[model samples]
Target: MSYPTSSSPRMWWTCTYAPGAQPFRGLIVPVLEEWSKSNVSDAFPFLAPIDHLLGSRRRISINLAKLFNFFDQEIVQRRLARTGSGSGSEKNNDVLDILLERHAMSKLTRQEIITFLTDMFIAASDTSTVTVQWAMAQLLRHPEKM
Candidate 1:
């Protein structure tokens, strides 16, 4: 149920990028931890209007933007390397590879590719962690039933 162990495979599968322990522990994990914190706006609908006033939304946005930019840069570098290699025949079974292939066919744009990578990281990483935590809590609470 550890975040890094649980999340790393999903991230790798999606982006073909493994953040490794340090970046996962220091960067991705902290963002998820902060995001898990409760917001007052969640309890009071009227407070939603002032959610940004507390700066939590702003901070989360900035952090997420940084994460997205990191992925974007990595994707760009991969594309550059692929072109620079001068052998376009090579292919790997990764999401980035698939996206690039589609891009070559004019099926997707650069911005779309970046957005897909960002969404994949966020959705896969967070959902896997939450699902594992929920399953563990349920099993612990109903050990006899299991």
Candidate 2:
């Protein structure tokens, strides 16, 4: 099948679906800023309490709470959309949709589902880097298989 040059697995949604307004686009920078700073406890485990006293923990909590709230909002909105959209509506098989589908069968708790998305978001870049390195190592070791 032919594909657009600008599209890949990552951009498939945008390629096939019309663009929608992104109201949260502006709020992302501050979230990045909050996450950019390394946690003190990460470097010095014994000094964990210092983070609480110095307000580092508070900042992290506020940022995470904001992020979690956004996730919660998205979940609710998706539920409404799925319910409101009859069979005529195009089905979206995104991660949240899949998780909600499982949730419908009582397979996952809201917290567990939300954690999956958050972990994916937090580790996506790091995971990609490691994945490429691992693939390269495997390819070099198994050229015959390749």
Candidate 3:
């Protein structure tokens, strides 16, 4: 998938699934931006190790690509469902959810499950890292107060 462009207002929605796009909504953007202010120049040194691991963009663009790929896979799964005889009660879950639920259904192969897990881990890490940093800052600032 290509990088998001300003041409489309809904580009972020296309890149990020609706549930995942919650943070990009107006309310969350301001909060994220406010939280991001703590990440000015000085934060770089502290984030150096992670920067080396995930790179400067934090692989956000890459994850957006993967998310797009996930959409394609969903289409494939839909076709499979249509062709295969399945009841209407068939479960509906996202890729990561399906990967985890596979222990009961065993639909995906081990390797496929692992790759799905990796993708989810990377996606979650991207969001959680920022939250962790903010919490850490609050902790450090309010050591005695906390």
TM-score of each: 0.74, 0.61, 0.32
Candidate 1, residue 75: how far the Cα is off, in Å: 1.5
Could you give the C-alpha RMSD of every candidate to the true structure, in order shown?
A: 3.6, 7.6, 15.8
Stretches of model 3 off by over 4 angstroms after superposition: 1-63, 86-89, 92-124
Off by over 4 Å in 1: 5-26, 136-144
- Model 2, which residues run further than 4 Å from truth? 1-43, 86-90, 126-146
Q: Is candidate 1 or candidate 2 better by lDDT?
A: 1
Per-residue lDDT of candidate 2, residues 40-145 (tens digit): 8889999889877888667767766776776677777777777786752444776677788889889998888777765655554245555777999999999997
The candidate maximizing lDDT is 1
lDDT of 3 at 119: 49
Q: Write the per-residue lDDT of candidate 1 for residues 42-88, one digit (tens) a residue.
A: 89978886777887788787877777776677667777767787986
In model 2, residue pairs whose N, Cα or C atoms come closer than 3 Å (at least 3 residues apart or on different chains), thus clashing, are none
Question: What lDDT tens digits, residue by residue, belong to model 3 across residues 6-70?
Answer: 22213211223454443223322332333234332455676656644644345444544454455
lDDT of 3 at 48: 59
- A best-first ranking of the candidates according to their lDDT comes to 1, 2, 3
